[model samples]
Target chain A: MQTNISVDLGGTNVRCALVDENGTILSIVKGSSNPEKGAQAIVDKIESLIKQLDNYEQANAIGIVVPGLIDQEKGIITAANNLPKLIDYPLKKQLEQDLGKPVILANDVKAAAYGEAISGAGKEHAIVYYISISTGIGGAAVIDQKLLSGFHGFAGEVGNVIVDPHYEAIGIMNAGAAEALGSGTAIIRIGKEKLGQQIEHAGNVFDLAKQNQKEAQEIVEQMTDHLSTLLSTIALVIDPSIIILGGGVMKGKDVFLEALDQKFHAKIFDAMRDIRIEEAQLEEPGIVGAAMLAQQSVSH
Target chain B: MQTNISVDLGGTNVRCALVDENGTILSIVKGSSNPEKGAQAIVDKIESLIKQLDNYEQANAIGIVVPGLIDQEKGIITAANNLPKLIDYPLKKQLEQDLGKPVILANDVKAAAYGEAISGAGKEHAIVYYISISTGIGGAAVIDQKLLSGFHGFAGEVGNVIVDPHYEAIGIMNAGAAEALGSGTAIIRIGKEKLGQQIEHAGNVFDLAKQNQKEAQEIVEQMTDHLSTLLSTIALVIDPSIIILGGGVMKGKDVFLEALDQKFHAKIFDAMRDIRIEEAQLEEPGIVGAAMLAQQSVSH
Candidate 1:
């Protein structure tokens, strides 16, 4: 099996792993991303992590997943909330030159969907909608075994679809958007404002809800309602064979899934009730997805 | 080029056309779909139309475009809004038995989208989203030259996606949905409720708006906003290479298209500014789309 290195770059850290054809991680390494040190430092950190994987086997190809609106065709990182200095940087070319291998870059959430579609929970479904409910809501879709990157490579931005048109919020906060109502960031923002530090983490909020905390329960219920609304919209639009849910918020929240499913059923048209909603199988879908993408690129 | 017979069954009319492989309509025929005379009468009307086409040329395949939910695999017209008796009827099998040729059935809007994608406005685009803005909003999507019929053949039901979650009206009345805001039905509904019967018809509404009627202008602007919201959602989610706008409302209303485009651009994120929205080229996309489906079935 050909060996490749896959990296998941985020605000705080950069995680790299050597993966085989079967998506098995042979060796893993991590390094901190010091934004205070600047874009060159981040590049340096990524290079060091690539070096750690270099000892295991010569990397045939490298795949990097980053959080941002990426220009994949040009291999440029357009804008990222965390890595501000990396804007407009030709990341693939820089990484390829430094690592001495071809490098491919993609949005982290899209990479995770690719990972799930190729080897994780969505493997059995032909069409899959993969959503991550983490610090913020992010999504990507896989149809007929291929990632559906739209004309501008921003196809699965489901979180931005406004769900509450009456709300004063604009852009991603519009009424129908999943992020506006259900995402972890939205949850934290709403909780902090409404509950006033009653819940430290979103998980704790969910825990509080489970333990019968009235405010926390209402908040979680509202979040689930928002998720269901988004799911119903997805069902009406894509009507995928299966929907794979992941991210930090969904890791241990089975009841939330149930509530979402119930709400989805209640809201969706009669023609779209059979769609299966399931949890993601891969522990770290983003890393796995990056590896899978590298494997696909190499194979093709 | 093989000859195919395409039939578009509507509430009041049963339109038939003999089409060639190049999407040319060789001959056309029409008759009333008198449902009061029962399903057999409708079948007889279809057979008579086929006979009219039979006099001109021999048909190798037959395709029927029906309005409502269709069970494609089973050839069943599950439930139709206009033709009540079409429910649970084996449409394809019955048509094949009557015409003595292979028959294919698809939702009318999906057929129109397929037609537009193959030979109409979306010919060169990789992804095409066709929206039919007539009495009610209907939509279908073609991705990578393949029709996206979700797990249960209901993939492109974009009209059902909720546009206004706060609205009490169920089905398509939600504010954010294209049908709720821009559809002819919505216009009539709004006119009846807000402006009363004096302004009847979408043309008069547009005319009044053109003449600087505040109420009329507000009604149109609100509808455009709703359509923009839905289009923005579609842009963010599907990110089609080109969006083809068709249906009765768009055929003569250039101003609606202009307003829709402006509102769509304002709502969509900067990452998806490059997607081109255009008007559909097919004169009768439903009939042409039915013919296209027939040809695809034969080739496959």
Candidate 2:
């Protein structure tokens, strides 16, 4: 079986792993993707990680997943919020030259979704929606065994959909987006303001909710309402065979999931009452997805 | 050139036309779709109209468009709000048997989008989003030269996306949705209550706004804001090559378009500023789109 090197490149960290054709990780490695050191430093870090996974004869392809607006067809990072220097970078070409192997690049979320669809929780389903509710809410769709990439390669942008028209004028943008209400970033922002120095991270906030913190509970309830509304809308539109929810916030939050399911059911129309919503089953979904995408592209 | 008979079935009337390979209507006809009489009566009306276009020797296919959730693969109308008896009806099989030719059935809005993408405003565009702002805001998407029908065949439910989380409990569920704010149904309801019963249609409401009626202007302004936010969200997510706006409400309302463009530009991210937004140019876009869908499906 062919193997591939998958790299999940974020501003803070670059996670590298040797993944078999079946999406099993043989060995793992890591490095820093420090943008302050400039684009070349980031490229060098990726190259060093590839060297660390030195089974050159075994690996046939390299897949790199990054954040932001990417032109997958051109293998270029158009504009990334996290890595500003990566704008218009010909990542595929640079990586290929550095590693001397066939390389594929995609948006991090899209890669994660493809990974989930092929080998994770979405493996058994024909149509799946993979959503990441972390610092930001990101999503991707796999329909009829193909990723639904729209004209400009910006499909599955569920996070930007407006949820409040009246609030548009108040500079309160992204109110309808899942990221604005349910993301870890949103939770932390609200927590800091409501609980001040009492809460540091979203995980701590969730812990507070678990311990019956009124403010924490209030934020969690608001998050549930936003998530339920977003999921209900997705259900009505896509009616996917399965919805796979993942990210840091969803890892061990069973209570949040239960509340979200109840709210989602109440809002959905009768016709779409039977849709299945579940948690993704992958330790490093993004890395696995990036590897799978590389293998699939090379084979095709 | 081969010809096909396309029928647009609505609650009030039925419009039929003989369309050639180039999407030209050779002959046109019309009749009533009186649901009070029953489903069989509506079928008979359709058959009679096809007979009027008596060049059956040249016709090779039959296409029917209706307002409802359609099971495209089975060629069945799963549920039609207006024609309630159409539930679980094998519309294509029955029509094929009656006409002695292949028959195709599709959702009216999907057909309209097909027409726009193939020959109207969205011609040659790889990604096209067609939105019908009539009684309700219905939308459809064409991606990678194919329609995006989700797992349950209800993919283009754009109107269901939440627009307002707070207002969802009362006035209208999901206030951020375009249908909740910009649809003809919403307009009529809000118009009658605020501007009196004199403003019956969307056009009349626009005329009232031109006359500087405060309530009428407010309604149009609010509707524009809603439309702009929805369009911006779509742009941020899909980044379609072009957005084609159609339906009865947009026929003569130029001011609404201007306002919508302004709001959309203001809200969309800088990277997605180059997308084209245009008015649809198909005459009876829905009927033509249905015909195109039928032909495309049969050929495939």
Candidate 3:
């Protein structure tokens, strides 16, 4: 019956939830992160948001998930793009001091992977790799019920892996990065360039591909092929029991799923060819995973 | 104080050694695998080789490391090209019965990585990735003192990862595979094709590159660049504490080390830019690693 507070700290907003031991959210609260104001201000806002919950004081622990590099052992945000001020900031210590409770901090994607590994589509699998093909691709891996945070908590950054060395670079990402080739933003950009018109999102390209438009189909095929390359590389290296695919780009999965599966199977090593690729089941893996971490932390 | 038997099963030879608990080889025995003769014949040769050792009965356990796919849990060589007759053969069970001792099984590269992780350059780090850029590139990852054997034990098959979609395919490897670009075999093949002369080995290309030969330098640069891509992909995905580079390619490392490091650093993610890449230290990691696994099996 114990409760824990879970917070999904994003660049634009902070989502707080009071979740029980079983990962059920008893209550929820949300507020603007106001990143332009700075890190401490956002922390203060998170505090205020949590205060809105009637049972905040009763929670045994608090978990916070954030985008960007995190020093898990030190509970510091090492490098956050949107919340740059939080770099090397001891967010967990600050939150613990204010909340008067234990705190667990992790990368947002890793937390989501843990959530999926514990109770979602990957629950039955011992090794789970969760990839979110959203605005930009991101990934996380959970092995034996624990997230594999490499030397600096950077494990499972699969999107950064190059799929084509000749492709144009996107922002900080290198040329031919899986993100630049397969992510939602990449799809839309390629779609616009090919159609000679404005395309609002990746779904438009998927729709065109489904209609058998040559240019759109080629673009979609490239995207899926690059994604397959990334997936096969992951399979060759990690060979997880299951890979759970999610994120906004998957909304139009019907157009690419079968093609992706075929391409991935074709490229993967013989020994790892059988790994199942499935869709992520949890709707709020971030919040639930944060809560799961909090619960596990307290139990340990 | 106790000893274990280690066997390195390759396509060309069967190497057996009696190693102490600390991985010190107390006695050695080697023999031709005569692979074309069949699996049982190879097994018999291996057994006879072990019997030739004076410490055969004194060994507590046995560890076998193989090149192709292995069912480690069941101790079977599922599909080995050289030992095709061993397909689905219960090598571990048979070895245990013949040796009258416990047995452990693992992939050769994985065993080498475990050996390095336990006592080589990677001993200082918790996560270690060992890559052997030899005739055909191969890789293995050790996390927390254990090799990461994926669902079907295909973890760390990095050479199969495609680096270029447009490149010509080599043998069973897909087009643009890291193996096709960076492996020692690839270097020789490309050197002969470009030089229009019979280049004996990869060393000739390095020797030419060191002398600032344009074509040779280009070939070496391409190899190093592809290696950098592979290493960067590994860093982004696994973010190991340290990466250990080994195999025949390292013999010509002086020609490519600095350039490889630069290329790898340039492509790796910002958070993972500091990962240290080092050389493999173990002189006989295969035998030592097999022995280590043997000792661990009994201890477990």
**Fraction of true inter-chain Cα contacts (below 8 Å) kept per model?**
0.73, 0.66, 0.86
The lDDT leader among the candidates is: 3
Question: What would the DockQ be for model 1?
Answer: 0.64
Candidate 3 C-alpha lDDT tens digits along B140-186: 88888877887878788888989888898888898899999899989
Model 1: how far residue A60 lies from native, Å:
6.3
Q: Which residue pairs clash in candidate 3?
A: none
Poorest 10 consecutive residues of model 2 chain A by lDDT? A164-173
iRMSD, all candidates: 1.4, 2.5, 1.1
Winner on DockQ between 1 and 2 is 1
Candidate 2 lDDT, B146-259, residue by residue in tens: 776767676667776666544443243444455777788778878988988886887778888888888889999988877787777666556687999988888656658888
Clashing pairs in 2: A163-A176, A163-B163, B163-B176, B163-B177, B164-B176
Q: Which candidate has the highest DockQ of all?
A: 3
Q: Tell me the tens digit of each residue's lDDT in model 2 across A168-239.
A: 322334544566667788788789989887676898888888999898899888888888877876665566
True-vs-predicted CA distance for residue B34, candidate 1, Å = 4.0
Error of 2 at B176 (Å): 6.2
Candidate 1's clash total is 16
**TM-score of predicted structure 3, chain A:** 0.93
Lowest-scoring 10 consecutive residues by lDDT in candidate 3 chain A?
Answer: A268-277
- Clashes within 3 Å, all models in order: 16, 5, 0
TM-score: which is higher, 1 or 3?
A: 3
